[model samples]
Target: MNELLLDLNEQQRAAVEYIDGPMVVFAGAGTGKTRVITYRIVYLLNLGVDPYNILAVTFTNKAAQEMKDRLVKLFPHKAENVWVTTFHSLCAKILYTEAKNFGLERNFVIYDENDSIKLIKECMKEVSVEPLNFSAYDIYELICRAKDNLIDPESYKINTMVSHQYYREIVAEIYSKYQKKLLENNALDFGDLIMKTVEFFKNEQFADIKNKYAQRFKYIHVDEYQDVNYSQVVLLKILSSVHHNVCVVGDDDQTIYSWRGSNMNYLLNFKKEFSTKDIEVKEFKITQNYRSKKTILDISNILISHNKHRVKKVLFSNIEGEFKNDVKIKQCEDEYDEAEFVAKEILKLQQIEKFYNSTVAVLYRTNAQSRVFEEVFSEYKIPYKIVGSVAFYDRKEIKDIIAYLRVVVNPQDTVSLKRIINVPPRGIGETTILYLETLAKENKTSLWEQIVKIDDTELSLKVKNSVWKFLSLYDLLKKYKDTMYPSEFIKFLIEKTNYIKMIEENNN
Candidate 1:
């Protein structure tokens, strides 16, 4: 194993074999940070440490999957013991299994902003507050920011940004009220999962959990440590306190999640929290050149060094490269001409004699800036794909389809019902839903199920007819669900129910 790491750079070798108290791999760009971590895990297992006693955490699901795959290939049978997961996913499992102790349900749902906002609008209406004056997005952002800083609603500060002193009081009250409603429905917003877990650990019940994980994981490895916020760092500390074998891998220059609540304070204060007095502190500088060219490396270095405090390191490139002088700055008159210029450049690249789909990349500061190239590519019938913040699975149409699938799998999902009730245009509007919800609560059944037993003394004839139409369509789909795949069934149902026509015919 030592011979295997003989070829690694000094920093990489130190990271791979440094089995000590606390370690930080302050690697630079193109450095083998990942390589070192991978080899470190293998080395730990080789040192007679139980694979089940290792916990590795990464930022993205893709990274998690990659690490899992790599580890499995390294030790095929022992991989199951190793837990590699994202924060949200791991917390969800913990919260779910321990829901009884934490005032949550085993069969609860998770709601994104859209569903949470819909519920908030309902609550505001019921409370007789002016919904138009206080937007749902604004409320969500407030809650999110509060959670990011580990500040609960009660601890949240107030200022003159609000109208009256009572405004903070009002909003604070509403925030708690919204949380109660979500709890009643057994739903968690995106930020709530981890925040609530943090709360769980701070209290007495999680003392048992803290000990269990801390003792279970003899060594804990954290990736992208600089991108971790306060709660996450605290969680890491709790899990590593037992054995104190903790290793973190990150580059301060790449810590770009500050706006989303990440802070460099944790990385800087890590040494303070975990003392190396009875332990070892290893700082490995995995500074190397492999990925980027000289020009790209120089620009990245200059642009990123604007940050106030970062672990100092250097990157170099063996190959020379060039970039557009002055960033090719220009001001086009209109969007069409801008698109044209981009199209011309792409065409010129394609016409080059040696070009055989050679890799070419064009990057912009934002999604809006990518539009010109996208439009030009479309106009010229160029084959291209946009990989940006918005993923295909995140599109509204796709999510709506998923909502339907959710409802089909679990008919009790009220949120999915609210989304697709009038979606196909049966004309059942907000008023009908409010009335149906009242009866569902009175009967204590799912809204959709209760609608089946409707004694229409309270419903008007028009609304009753619309409800019948919706029920008929749902029944039709359920009757034939097994015959069709999700996409095909959705397409068929939309066409047969005249939903496509209704939506497309809306000229307004």
Candidate 2:
């Protein structure tokens, strides 16, 4: 037996060694699923499979990176060849290489949620649909859901039904105009990355392109498979159509992303989708609860068994201990009472069990649920830090800095330019910016270009001076773009833009 197989349990070992056909691992919570996945890749490599021919996809960047890091430690020489990335990242790579087939440039901008909302709002305004009546956010979400289901604008208009015909008509128009704007700006929203890749594969003109990738990746591994949406399902199916050597690891009970279009039906129906005449899909279950005690596992199993759609599997504790008192259930009158209970429980555990405050943690379903917990904890003076609060990249300061860099690289990125143009109290009021946007639209030019030719536009002396100062700063950054390293350029931008001073004043 290999060193990799030594550490795995019976089911984990079986899963790692099974490379004959399509397989689905019904991995229970905390059953070393990630470990099984990493070892399975190693197992294939030991059989003389080329690392370049394998693809391992997961949902989050953090998980993908962790897998890559583990592989690097095990196979430092061959790890670089493996395709370990998120679904969106894999699609982005494919799209970047074959963008021309879809009439998109390789350097097309990828719009974030904020940019998408801004574009949707613009489209709504153009179609004379007021934002107050129909929120831009809601419309953007509808568009995203449509894209996730692989429905194009024309298909959406034809198939969609709403109570009010006028509202449906307005949304359809906005969807059409929004897609047109995305193309005109050479941009793709987050949903488009997966939707476009699926589109490219299904297009008959790109058969060779699809076949190239299908033939390239012989073994495909998808983690958290239950959270896959329709577009992603189509993508995996197309990629594995040739070889049929796909392995997915997930539990139907763990499907929590339905609002984001994730369908557990895909995982539940894996065998039906992948089985063929020559090869049969194999199902494996790893039900050992490595992270919990027997009492807790018993309670969890009993509670989750009520879910009608999940696969029936019993989780047994791998650990041997007398943990009869481990399971506890408490009922509270309201959120405030629940929060108080949690805070008091934490304090009691720290004092009675001699546990460190740093070792204790709390988990919540949504961001809004954290407010009560925070209030209770603060009142108790409990030393704590929130995990997964607002992400670093989502911070206003971070976004403002990134916008500056984006405008420097792509002057036509009006979304990013719009974000930073009036930032730092530039005195570039909304009315002035709106005027420039109107002029740019009429002239068929970008906002950056309009700003560059601002001297020719009709504007007040005060507004013109502020605008010129901003342009001068932008031009200086553009001049040093190639000369300075990224770090130095960022420092120079902070100093030149007086960004730190603005942040200080705002904080005050």
Candidate 3:
């Protein structure tokens, strides 16, 4: 390494030069993990590897941008050619240019949790099945797990705590149908995208591309490697087969996103998988932290040490500790009040010189706890973005509008359909839609269209009128499809659907 680049610590220096091998750098939080990754790319470039021959994957867009910035500072023109991107963004790019060969459309929409839940609810309605003691979120999780295991939904079955043979059979059936509906819309949940893409690479058609990508890239360096899911790891394994130059930097102690599908198994299995005849395996540790003070490091060590499976890690720091004595233990008065208290402390710190524009985040064990912080912050006009998943249920006006837009986008979405079915105090109830769906399927038309043409003899005249009005509103939406984005289309829907009228009269 050059003198300027050789300035990195011993761990960092080892991280940079081990560019030719399958190396795993076990870096603790606040360590120079970022610096090591950046320097590795420069080292590869210095070794006569083309910039386009290196791939660096990060977990977030912000990190991807930072990697590019760091690379550009060192090698100047080399930044533009290096592939530094989040998994989703990289997959989206691949799908945009190459997915057509794999039978996927270029313009396929990403179904965030809200879209998936909306679709799931619609399928439940279609099956005349009410959700049994489970929320839409619960079903989404089950679906995600199924996808992660690469279980083809066609032959999928749900084995759950529900002991009844009949109920288990019923959920499995509903799941099969729900998956078909997603496929019809060219939609894959986040997990499905990764899993399916892995499957695609394994198939004959993508085998050449896999070889091509691997040969094109000299070294594959992954950031936040602890956050890799099964499918992602599979993709990395395949792509690295050709070049056998993969470097991953992560701390097993920070493996905290199990609920979001991050697999701890990958880190544990990294060495065994990466070691082959042509491949070299090396391991390095970065125990020292630059970001945290000595006290903060001590606090983290005490708490994380309890995770027995975590690799033995210690955070050594020269910076002064925050507390005179380390106070590692934190007690929260339930999740909500804990957040409220945290919000108060953060707002108090906002007045300090250093705290300016430094976001004070209150991490929660669950999304529900975010509500407390949100309410407290909003009251004080503290600006913040609700990160993680889609914040549909979080926004009042947007949820109201999404209800209307979902009705327009996919009439098949059952949860919102159920919510809106009688929402306008529409005289139509649950049984009516079930019967209507059956009739619509029989006639091969929309339930709204089927209800419109059905005779009034079996139905109440009031119910008949509401169903006809619903069909007329759908017809109007069809007419104005040329004029609106999904948002404005929903705006038109509330007025045109007379849904608010139903709400107003019911409120009276």
Candidate 4:
């Protein structure tokens, strides 16, 4: 046996060595699914398989990075050749390379949630819909759900069934306009990354491009298969259709992203989806629980057994000893009671049981549930640190800086251009922006292009001068764009735009 397969148990060893055809591993929680994934890659490498032919995808960047780090330690020389990344990151790379086929530039900007909401609001305003009547975020989510299910704007308008015809027509119009604006600005939102890649592969016009990638990646592995949406399933199926060498590892009962369009059916019917007449899809179960105690595993098995649709598997603790003290259940009348009980329990655990605050953790289902616990913890004088209160990219300052960078890279990015045009209070107000938008609509051009031709528009001299100053800032940055490295250009942008100075003055 290879050294890499020495530590795995019998079931995990079988899963790692199964390289003949399609396989689905029903990996229960705490069963070392990631370990099996990484070791399987090692097994393939030891068999003289080219690392460049392997592709592995997971749900989160952190998970993908962890897999990559483990691979680097195991196969330091050839690990970099494997395509280990999140689905969105892989799709973004494809979109960036083949963006011209989809009528977008290679340097297209990717809009975040805030940018998408802003554009949705603009579309609503253009279609004569009041923000008060319909929330911009709600509309943005609708469009996202549509895209996740691989529904384009035209298909949404015709096939979608809504309660009110008026609202349906309104949303369809807004969706069409929003997509048009995204293209005009040379941008794609986060959803567009996956949706467009699926589109590119499915389009018959791009058969050669699709075949090239399908042949390049001979083996595919997907983690968290239960959390993949319809578009993702289509993408994976298209890529694996040629070779049929794919392995998906996930527990269907662990599916929790249904609110974001994740369909557990894909995982539940994996055998049916991948099995062919010549080669039957193999199924393996890794049911040993290494992270939890015996009592916890028993309780989880009992609770999850009641689920109507799931693969039949029981998880047993691999740890020795009875371990009967881990399982506990508490019921409360409401969130307040639950919060109070949790805080008091934590206080007891710290004061009497001598457990450190760092050793204890409180898990909640939703972020909104944290408020009550926070209040209760404060009353009890318990020091707590929220793990992911606000994502780094979602911060206002970070977004503003990214917008500046986006504008520098792609001048047609009107959403980013609009975000930073007067960010530091350059005297060009909303009224001036509205005027420019109107002129841009009339001339059928982007906001940046309209600003370039501002002299041709009927605007106040003061507004025109402020706009000219903004244009000059872009001109200065464009001059150094090819000359300086990306890091150097960012530093130059912050200095030339006085962004850091504005932040310091505001803080003071």
The residue pairs found clashing in candidate 3 are 53-218, 121-414, 121-415, 122-413, 122-414
* Per-model TM-score versus the true fold: 0.80, 0.93, 0.71, 0.95
- Pairs with backbone N, CA or C atoms under 3 Å apart (clashes), candidate 4: none
lDDT of 2 by residue, 70-157 (tens): 9888777787689999999999999998888767887787888988998998998898887789999988988898888898877776
Give each model's whole-structure lDDT. Answer: 0.75, 0.88, 0.74, 0.88
Q: Which candidate number maximizes TM-score?
A: 4
The residue-by-residue lDDT of candidate 4 on 159-267, one tens digit each, is: 6445677777788899999999898888889899999998888889999889888998888999888899988988998989889999999987697899789988989
Counting clashing residue pairs in each candidate, in order, gives 0, 0, 5, 0
lDDT of 3 by residue, 282-379 (tens): 88889888887887777789888898887786879999965697543558877666666676777788888877644655566777767777887888
Q: Which ranges in model 3 have alpha carbons more than 4 Å from their true place? A: 1-7, 158-168, 326-440, 443-508
Q: Candidate 4: lDDT of 216?
A: 87
Candidate 2 Cα deviation (angstroms), residue 50? 1.5
Model 1 lDDT tens row, 225-332: 888887788777777888888999888777688877788777766667677567656666676777877777777777777876877767776766665452445688
Judged by lDDT against the true structure, how good is candidate 4? 0.88
Q: For each candidate, C-alpha RMSD in Å?
A: 5.0, 2.3, 6.6, 1.9
The 10-residue segment of model 1 with minimum total lDDT is: 155-164
